[model samples]
Target: MEYNIDLQIDKQSLIETKSFLIKIGNKESNWLGDVSIHHQATDKFRLLEAVLLDHRLNVVRKIKAKDVYTKNADSRSTFFDDHLEDKFSLRHNQFPYYIKYSYRIIKRDFLFLAYWIPQYYSNVSTISSSLSLTRPMDYEIHLDSIGEFTYSSTRAAGLITEKWSIKQPKKIGKADFSPPATESLQQISIVPSDINYGVKGSHASWEDFGEWVANLNSGLDLLPEEEIATLKKKFGHIEDQDTLIKKLYHHLQDNTRYINVSLDIGGMKPHPAEYVLINKYGDCKALTIYMKALLNAFGIPSFYTLVESGSNPKSIRENFPSQQFDHVILCVPTKSDTIWLENTVSYLPYNYLGSFTQNRKALLVNKGGSQLVKTPALTHTDVHQTNTYHLTFEGDRLTGTLYSKLKGEDYEKIAYVETNLSSQEKKKYCHKYFNNQGFELIDLTIHQNSRSLPEVELTAQIDLPKHLRQVGPLRIISLPASTMPASEVFKDRTRPVRLMMPIDAHDKVIIDSSQNWTWKLPENFSLISEFGTYQITYELVNNSPVINRRISLGSRDIPIENTAELYTFLLEIETYESSAPIIPTH
Candidate 1:
């Protein structure tokens, strides 16, 4: 069964007529659906209210009165066509029907009316329609629902209006819905259709759309053949199949800008490719088709591919043919691979496919026919980040320099910050990146190699506070200098212990002392807590003490999943210290 809907709306607050035609087997069912529109009344002014029409042709059921509502008012109304029949049914078990409905509003200011068009099965009883017997019965269905809503308001700006449509289907008893006698219900065909109408306050009309495309196509003929040939010779160089296709693919990506424009005005017929080129901007369809035409001029084979931009994973069934795509792209065929090009961003990479297009199936529409194509897989090797740092300590002050290199989408973020941020802002940014480490930055430098790669290298010299040292007979403290005894720092003994220094990672300390300052031994000193490699190496150089302390305490590789553990580990390492009391040496 197939269904079709047609609607026409005017500038007045009236709907002339909304019609529907449903085709089931050899018979066609027609219905007239319309709504009498109204507007809101206000003091010193009156505005027409936008009207919404909801009607499905395939489903035969009662229309409830309470299903509709009006704004700022308590009452609602329900009206039906007196000349048309109330209900209709189909004779064939596997055919589809069409339903059409529309309405209008007089005031151009209230142009934002919308509709919540329900699916056909929402009103139908599935229990009664269930087929009997285990025999195979093939069935297919198609749905075409369109809404043209318009409104204007003085409080709001100009008139806002739109017309949107969708086509969906329901299939039963088949493996992946492949058309054949492989499973039960092998011989069934169903098609559903619908149409809708509304009004808008604009001088542009459907005829203007057709004229625009036609005139643009005619203008293409005016270009000199020699110039066209020259353009082809310059742009078309396909030495290697993959390289050629990739170049052509990148050509479209670098040339066109994407603007979202719908086809309800001209019923999905695209504008002239030459016009789009002059404008340098167009909708997905216009840009895609333009790329296709350009490739054809250069003896390259290409096609238009349509797809939906969401997470729905159902494949398209050939038994049902209807427009279900929300986006359009270009597909170039080469000896080795078929390249997909999206003509939205002039800066997007030639081979980089966004998450929206990743691993999704698309319909490739060519002169021959439509075929399905799956997007290539994305691998972890395509993404990576590298960081390097140099650290040194001089007289209790630690100085370090850091460099970071990023690839893939991560580069996009750092590149923007690198270009826009000032020197002071960059210091603030570095502080944040280092977990708010209290360090004085001496120098900060950022270098970007390429915009396409979107990679940035940052280098900075930073000074950190000195907190640990030994004095005279005993070590003053192994803990950070910021820590103080509770007796002096806190008046109340019950007060919580507080440390001034922020702890992020474990630290290692090496000390070189002069032999003239003789060290006294702490007889009672003992190790308290330890993790990983916490060792000290002592060597005598010219009778002087050269002490090397190495500590490996934190996880080498931080896991995002264990971020909480990492934080806890940081806190634990910060508080860790040897508390064993030192005994005076004789």
Candidate 2:
């Protein structure tokens, strides 16, 4: 794949002329045959030309990008479609073909000058790529890049011309638990030092960017007189600040839903609190501002926070700050501690950010300008979970009741199951959760301890069809597959290990049989290392064996050299718990 881009910046708009040359190597790379150009609703786009060429480099056909498709049709992720794609499809019969297409986009409201990524997809090699950018001599911009590239610049006719090129890019090997591409990929980011996103703003620094955000959202938190009266009438009597905050947060959740409104500065600027109050729906930004307004009604102060929120969020370029955040949250400071609220999600417990927004730096926008602050980080204990099973073996079958207590991300999973799934869907989910080990789920129940705390309890009664497996002359109890086995997950890892959160889990099992069945107690095992720790114990009580196990791995970015040790630890755990051998007394 090769990309040739020319960017011209002026006071009114930024114009980008982009051309792509993609070679389809096989059936897997056939997706390159289709061309897609993405742009916001505010931008003007035009496709100049598209041509399909054979392996011999002769033009076979010409295509046009006439179809416009909405960017996201999934209602679950996007309530309101905010972007469009200009698509050109070229169907070819032969492999090793080439597709060339070029287009132009005029961006009137943009936060960043350019985000040039030469290699957009994984496992795809780039032959050559180049960028020619021109801007006014007085305009100041900052450039940040990862990986190797060549750069050159010149000044002529009161304009600065900058050229960047990447040739024969090296391959990045896949690895288990690798960091996000933004952290590891070869890319370039260009940020302007000042102005223009429908309104005046600055991208010179984090503080400047945040102050611009504050100014954009200024006076958007004002509530109507009646709304203020209603709020006071509902929660004015609550003297405790925490209780008040919870009440207000709950009110916001109950009253509003999330939608995307990208009309304002291409969704960079949020709609006002009054809009949400009247419409009962808003995007993350609007919902956060609404919550802020609700808190401010009672003289409580909160900062509108911007964060790159996701399971594995893109790395934030803190030094060259631009509009990098995709989600908006609210940060409230109280007497005892600070509270972070994810206003878009009604299912999340109050003040809980979960794994989506936790353990990351966020920009707080306030009257005092912007400040960077770290969100709450979870330790192994924070995500602790326990599973207990009481089992009885009769003939070749096993019946048992399992109870699970989940916290942190585990709690979030079960919470989602409880909130989103139906009775039949939950049953199917439980079967999959148990690794589909031929266990018949007789009964399953999900329980939430409280609405304030993010925790869940699950009780399930299951019957294993054939619990006993005869190996030679002995019977062994077949166990569910390990969640992360070394062979499947940690094998041939080339990248450094990066964990988003720590893991701490415990398991206990009590085995009894109506028939006189005895089992040899396996020797206890324990291992501790820098990667993590593992321990398992066995006890004999009333001719039955009670087993307990615990595993913990701290959250950290470990280098590739240390992953071998971790892989060995995981291998040992996998070998030790493969099956349980049993002896039947006649």
Candidate 3:
């Protein structure tokens, strides 16, 4: 069944106010299924209306009929839940669920222009069938007229049966556009009372913590004296628990290889420490728990810390424990440095935490109990690199040599790539890197130093087509590549753009020319032609020449129905050129 939806929003205030409206609908084949609409609300706000559109018969059902005041007190609303499964027909050719809500401030001065922001699925889902939006709706305040505003939008739709289509809303105006400085508007601090700390497994009492350690030792089948002596030495240093914990953590980190292969049952519980020792590889949880047990054997206090491994974005839940943590490490407090051990990575330098684990809240679980602590940040000195390259041009052929000095994570990335790739595969990879300039590489080579702060140097010889150069008199002459014409590429012929080559990060490129050529031609080549340098930088460099010769042309922006014209425009440009030769008449 086909459907059409129209949504509108309007707001008027004594001063300035921030307001928005959202409309969401879903189409499914079956009539009985769950529909979820979750949103956060606040006091002094209103949820104006929510209507369902029965497109087949063109009827609208008022599912929620309440004034703004009745719904203002609660900060959450569930329009539909499990109870509503039998109440509404959720099958095909039925009413489409639609929701539209707007809010305004009754008190305080609202100083900023309002916007309608849309968040599609974070990851694409294959179950959506259709998704689209007309121009996004937005209201902007003009600089000269502070109180006045402008608004515009059309309709948007998302439809699905078996697959999903996700389209995030486009920004209505310039993101950086803002009103002039105003002292009345203050930055708001939004702090939620509840943060998700993730789920907890079956707990062992504090007294059982030691027993758990003893069981782990026996289960690993470790040598009796080796285990006992190791435990005694670790426990013997009671004067400094922090140092003992750090030592145990370092031991675990040094011995373990961080491979993220999780068995179903092992994901929830730690792997046997003996298995980890034999395999030398385990996921974050396994390694972290193993470290904790080792610390316990030594009588040092340590804990397993669980947190998501990435930029620590704010959590959306109000009071739920965080269940989204993907990585685990260890935290031990010493008298000198509060040591945070990321046992998942074996190559990382001691006392160094990359940005992936920095400044995020993690749950620390130990016999002393679980609590939240923030991981430390990485400094500039921890991971830095310097790159340098030299290029020389012979005719249209270019040869270059590149060198990179890497530290920290940069070195690890290079080492991993080198170990995994074969010599021929590395050459193909270098070809793509040089192909960024639309050139073909003739030969490529890679060299590396296996010592401290590993470095990879790449050298390549490439061919830059001679047609890219320009010659001129009254009309500029250029030879574009067989793939495209200069006019089509430089569609906006009003200005010229500069060209730049991409080098590695922190790298410098020096171009050297072995020979220079200048030409003096006949009377036909002599004319009053103006020439100057052209330079503009967009996302990348666009430096191709322009010719003023007249040629037969086709329409611009061909319509979709004219498939032949579109194909001709795309394929015919390669064959376009002057068919006649230039001749001088006396």
Top TM-score model? 2
- After superposition, the stretches of candidate 2 with alpha carbons farther than 4 Å from their true spots are 65-76, 422-424, 436-440, 465-467, 478-488, 579-586
Candidate 3 root-mean-square deviation in Å? 18.7
Query: Which of the two, 1 or 2, has more lDDT?
Result: 2
Quantify all predictions' global Cα lDDT against the true fold. 0.40, 0.80, 0.39
Q: lDDT: which is higher, 1 or 3?
A: 1
Q: For model 1, what is the alpha-carbon lDDT of residue 213?
A: 33
Instruction: Quote each prediction's TM-score.
Output: 0.41, 0.95, 0.42
Q: Kindly report which residue stretches of model 3 are placed more than 4 angstroms away from their true locations once superposed.
A: 1-266, 292-301, 311-320, 332-339, 345-351, 407-412, 420-505, 516-586
Best by lDDT: 2
Q: By lDDT, rank the candidates, best first.
A: 2, 1, 3
Candidate 1 Cα errors over 4 Å, as ranges: 1-227, 236-238, 246-256, 261-269, 309-325, 391-401, 412-586
